[model samples]
Target: MRLTIDHRTTYRFTAPQGRVVQLLRMTPRNTHDQTVAAWDINIDCDARLREHRDGFGNITTMLYAEGPLSGIEISVSGEVVTSSSSGVLHGTFEPLPAALFLRSTPATHAEPALAAFAQAATVGRAPIAALHALNAAVHERFTLVDGRPEAGLTVTAAFARETATARDLAQMFVAAARAAGFPARYVTGYCDALPNGRPTPHGWADAWVEGLGWVGFDPTLGRSPEAHHVRVAVALDAAGCSPVAGSRLGEGREWLDVEVQVSGQD
Candidate 1:
């Protein structure tokens, strides 16, 4: 399958800002499951973009803009050809060991509730089977809420609400997978499976299997990602895998807006 993606992010500040810096994890790399045919990033203002690879082997761009300015716009577009990989990541770079992902972050720390739930879901099961069960269990446990969370909520908080955004859902999945003795990481990218070709950025979990390597599980969709899931970045937590993150100088208040469109090709 072939897919085209367009993602734009706009930032508006109530007061004029002096400088803006951003880390962009919006580029997808070539892997066994997908090939990047073309990709580009554009900014409304003059800025320098430096490319690097993060510890999780994700392509990252460092963006810098000097401003006595009020706002900035960043746009990214790309075409990718993808094939089904049965959720296994092949031909992907892994600079960090899988065990590194076992380390918990505040957002993904398995609290008592999470630990008990994971234990109940995977007790006495084999690794692969237990991972699958945990994935399905998480899917059944929480509803996918529309829109972003008002704030970045921890996995435990999201699990308690009975509804969660994709990021929180992935965090919950990662926490549960770790509690079940599987090394898991958070993945962020674009997904083309939404209704009416309405593209949205997505988050999922990757669990390391003894023989299968890194296998993806998307609890928001209650299954593994396939051709429609475009993998971009992976990290121990959502903050680290965020599509865009950075700091600004001289800010009173800032507002952000994001728009995305994804469509399938014939």
Candidate 2:
């Protein structure tokens, strides 16, 4: 399958700023199952973009802009070709050991209730089957919602809700999988399966199975990711792999708008 993606993020501030700096994990890397064919990032204003890799081995771009500016627009467009991998990752860069993903971040901390739920959901099953069960359980537990995820929402809080955004569901799955004794991490990427375009990129989880290495899981879809999924960044939690994280020197208030479109063809 060939996939095309167009993503734009805009930030408008009530007060002009002196400077802005951002770290972006919006670029996808090539793996055995997916190949980046073409990619570009455009900033509406004068800015400097430096490419580098983060600790998690994700391709990152650092943006620096001088201000007195009211707003900034960051746009990214790309094309990628992917093949069905049955959710098993291969030929991807791995900078850290799988055990590192087992470490929990604040956003993915599993409280007692969540931990117990994980235990109950996966009991009496083999590792792979248990992971599938946990994924389905997480999917069944929430009413999937769309739009930007609530900032700083933790897994425990999200798990308590009857509705959750993709980010929340992914984080919940990561937390639960870790509690179930599986080394898991959060993933931020794009999926071509949505009928309508989305305002934000997709989110999911990946777990390290002993014999299988890393395998993808989408609690939002209640299945493993395949050709329709374009894998990007992976980290202990969403914040660690956020597509954009930045700070402005001056700030009164700011409004953000995001638009994303992902389409695929065989």
Candidate 1 lDDT score at position 15: 93
Misplaced by over 4 Å in model 2 are 195-199
Question: Which residue pairs overlap in candidate 1's backbone?
Answer: none
Candidate 2 local lDDT, 85-181, one digit each (tens): 7889999999999999889998999999999999999999999899999999999999888878899999999988899999999999999999999
TM-score of each: 0.96, 0.98
| Cα lDDT tens digits for candidate 1, 1-266 | 89899999998999998999999999999999999999999999989999999878899999999988699999999999998878888988898888888899988899999999999999999888888889899988877776765566888888788777778888999998998788999998888885342356878899999888999999888888889888899999988889889789985998988888887775
- Reference-based lDDT, each prediction: 0.87, 0.93
Give the Å error, residue 43, model 2.
0.4
Please state the error at residue 93 of candidate 2 in Å: 0.4
In candidate 1, which residue ranges exceed 4 Å CA deviation? Answer: 195-198
For candidate 1, the TM-score is 0.96
Worst 10 residues of 2 by lDDT: 192-201
The local distance difference test score of model 2 is 0.93
